[model samples]
Target: MKPQTRFNRRDFLQTATAATAAGVFIGTSSASHAQDSPNERPVFATIGLRNQGWTITDKSTKFADFAAFADVDANVLGMINEKLEKKTGKKAEGYKDYREVLDRKDIDAVMIAAPDHWHTKISVEAMLAGKDVYCEKPLTLTIDEGKLIEKIVKQTGRVFQVGTMQRTENQHRFLKAIALIREGRIGEIRKVTCGINGATGSPVIPAIDPPEGLDWDMWLGPAPKVPYRAGTEMRRGYGGGVPLHTNCHYAWRNWYETSGGQMNDWGAHHVDIATWALDASETGPNKVTPVSYSLPVEYKDGYPTVSDQYNSPTKFEIHVNMPGDIPMIITSEGDNGILFEGTKGRFFVNRGRLAGKPIEDLETNPLPEDAVEKVYGGAVSENHTANFIEGMRSREQPISDVWTHNRMLETCHLANIAIRLGRELNWDPTKREIIGDDEANSFLSRESRKGYEINM
Candidate 1:
């Protein structure tokens, strides 16, 4: 069945403004007016309409009205808008800049799937604008970004749901694993190993012009400007083609300027789950040590020395010492899953499956029906997006709240810093500072490109 568009962008924004000014009372309450009905629901806008962005927006249509959309690539924006309109008969206003979407008072929320560098800026702005935020995983490109977003969310009383959907989704796989650990089915967990796979790099490629319809400058956002290199010059398997060099779209995650590669990509999910199970969401690893690591290209003083090749670490074996003397090892070897080694039992879980002694015991001993719900803090939703929607209505935090999510991101960012520096680094979680190593501490945050700076 096709969903009907009830209000255009301008009309929706205008109506929302007056209603909010009068304290008309929407959100989780029954309203006498049809316009304010939960049936009409909240309206949302999406930024960065690429692969993941498209998927999220499409899925979100079932729960909210997508009033508008924005993307640096005009081609992506047009294509996604057309698809949304065709699929649901609800057309969204398109914008080349995300700021335009934030400028609208009608938008009740925004789904941010922009690159890692842009995540903090847009999320903070959206919150200050009084919009709930649903931002994709690996929440920030740096530790400071995570802290900034957390602070802004708290200050604004905004509901922020990070893309670590495993907490609410995963079909109860991660929740079950966490439940076992929390319920004492797994005797004290000695160590947890998360194998997050590896990164891909390309040979040096020459600078070239960005494709038509792409706003290259806006796409670069907060990252330093560099010459655009068409990825066609580079080998496919090693490094991807154009957009890879300039840190745009698909290739941005592999570069240090925009992302933390697999460390943050997969680390954000698995490491986040690990922290949740350990009840260490507020505090993170005290010591991070990189045993062995490899970068695709040379780097000088933490910056990639080369421009053309993929620069993130390709392989790494890192050991992190957590608060309770629990050692967590993050590596790129073995099946891509998290392995929990505990005194009584052990288990492994990824998106696909959760297995081991604990799971087998569950069949016989049988966990209470509330086992998974307990891990979810109450009820599990149909999916991660549903949790965000529920949080928006109740003004409560979703399963993956920004503060705890930031703690997980801190671990991932610190691991990346340690790998890049090729040494061990001590971290004071309480002070949120690096201990004794000024050089290492310098990597905790980065200066965003002018005009894109994250401001309170």
Candidate 2:
């Protein structure tokens, strides 16, 4: 099979709109009518019903019913089912395979909180099946998957929202701060430094059989097959099974095959903010050059490792040359915050504090009313899930729409690619191709295991 080439923005938009028009999008406003009038609730299903899935499910209860739940592990399914019964006073059907959930016509939308590898496949398939999707962050596992998902979202006209929740936070005043910068509050922007840490190392463990009621092959999905390692530490340090299993669920973020490490994990948040603030949400950096990078010398706890066992970079400095502006450095330090260097002075923001020269200026400087409206797309919802439900009804794009998300994912994935290639590379955003680097280009998409190809 030929490798898929990236689609241009215009093609993506046209495809998406057409898909929506072809009965793919049952507008959110109609969702209530579609359900209540017909003795149904806008039937919704959740994939990977674990940590994030439970939260999304709880929040979505107001707009839709939890019609179904799917997970690779039975233990996870049992736990979520018990919770669903306790909370909703109703039972939801459970399945081990996500594809089974997608096959249901009654399901109008799907909330995908699966690991990175399953995100693209589940989302693309859900859209293809005429369902809206709320996929978890770091939208795709690869740059190619990002472009592919962007195209699928547009082509299918399905309301798709990447789970970059920071965009929905009210206290993270960075949204308003970014509007100020774009509105010339901070003068010409000079540089943006995004602080994101790297991945941690996995503990060595012997190969073992798949855990009970877990479909290990399905969990592997499109990734290359490897023997199951018992008690092997995965990324993010969440144990797979045994209290001592130590890795697999939450910790999967440390592995390149399962996660984009800090580049994708934190990049989904901070890099997204930087791109939105810089008014570069529709595009990405022209160049990504790594000035410095270091792998974990020894697998000390807390710090990330660069061992081949984990694909994410541990310590690195990535210089990104934005279009028509000073280059920005995305590093693994600076207290994991966003620092903006402008001609007037510098402003820094993170999950907590927002500080800079004349720090009080942020509160008083106030972004123009029109700018805030534009940034939030007119309707402001305090909740991300609510925004998706609202967007589903209004037929308007959500906060983390596919187009903007692809651009953000591109930045993080390119940084990872540059680190992996160990060389500077030029990216042509319009063409959506890597210039003169076939080796780097090859990494854009991976071959699916079989029977999982994304088709238009």
Candidate 3:
């Protein structure tokens, strides 16, 4: 079949009622970027200032100028603003709301490292405002959001990159691994395992007042309102805080209302690479079955019965039957890495190292040293952030484009759904539906809180 080279906004709108935003967007596209002179850099704003957000922004300074910053927590916002001002030598304007930063015409791009629930909304708005986007992993909080973002990308023709940085870093370890798989070194992959580890469980903590300078209401945004409950971690860790509202920072990944537990947390990274290796970036599993799962709280129809405690599944194992009858297993039972078993050999890789018979054989049989370079489109030197900034200037799609990432994210979302439903699901990837299962189909999109409905 021919690949989808174009998208009809009207056709998409008609079929994707659940994914549509509250209203139409009529903003004009930003003017085409002028040819740049040496020493000039694209101006950008960052919408989140916590852990991953700060890390990405720090790396991004190499390619773009920090023009603005925004965060729901005013204290965090001020802290980053002060740091950037001192580090960059230019005072960056900070805002408590992301919309204020998006409204700035001078800002040509945005780095959206907000919570999963906020990623689609902020990214869509930024693109509509004529800004390129760099969003953190697990691009969408739900399947429908993936489709929504795909439509907006086509409509805007803006450069967008998902923060699956494993594709770009680590001396091209992942790139080499992918090339080896595609080169038939692993024969024909029969089975693959993605060990993304497990989720965390915590006792229900009591609620209290929010911290000073934090806009707790705005922080909750579209998610249902719950009392503030602070965490007990140290000041340096993600959950450290006096008991108040829900934990922010890295701790948010463990809640179903805000994120997708380890299924998306690490699934966004390992499952993504597995999909790329399988050459299934544009397609996915036709069957998803939940082999086992353990949630911290009871759930009914995919909604948590209790609001307190970390509600995402703490332990789970899922099996996805992909196109070509390949079995992909996602589990928390092993080390955090991907293990591929093929007819010829098997290999395992994580952030720290890549190893196995196939990799060892390469030392003797020698894949042309240029093998890894070719997998990266011959640009082995650029890190992920540099690739996005350069793509912006060249009008090319970044290494981790939204289309492929969304397809991979869809696979992750499907696994989560199967676990939540406690059954097998037959999927129609092309139609983006769950076959013969109305209940599972309903899980594709979620109802956004009023006033927070994403406007496509």
* Model 1 global lDDT (CA atoms, 0 to 1): 0.80
Q: Model 1 shows how many backbone clashes?
A: 5
lDDT of 2 by residue, 252-314 (tens): 676766787788889888988888877776667889898887653433332234333444567
lDDT of 1 by residue, 1-456 (tens): 001111222233354456556876333222222133455578889998887898788888887889899998888888899999998897999999888888787888889998888898899887777678899998888887777776665555566788787887768889888888878888999999999998767767677778899888888888898866655434354333334444565777888888889999999999988887777876888999999989999887777877777899899999999879999999999999899999998999999999887888877898888877777777788888888887666555677777778888888999999888878889999888899999998888899898778655
**Local error of candidate 3 at residue 334 (angstroms):** 1.0
Q: Give the TM-score of candidate 2.
A: 0.86
For candidate 3, what is the total of clashing residue pairs? 9
Writing each residue's lDDT as its tens digit, candidate 3 over 329-412 gives 999988999999999999999899999999999878878776776677665647888888776765556788887788888888
Model 1: residue 414 alpha-carbon error in angstroms: 0.5
Can you give the TM-score per candidate against the true fold? 0.90, 0.86, 0.91
The worst-scoring run of ten residues by lDDT in candidate 2 lies at 1-10
- Could you tell which candidate, 1 or 2, scores higher by lDDT? 1
lDDT of 3 at 182: 67
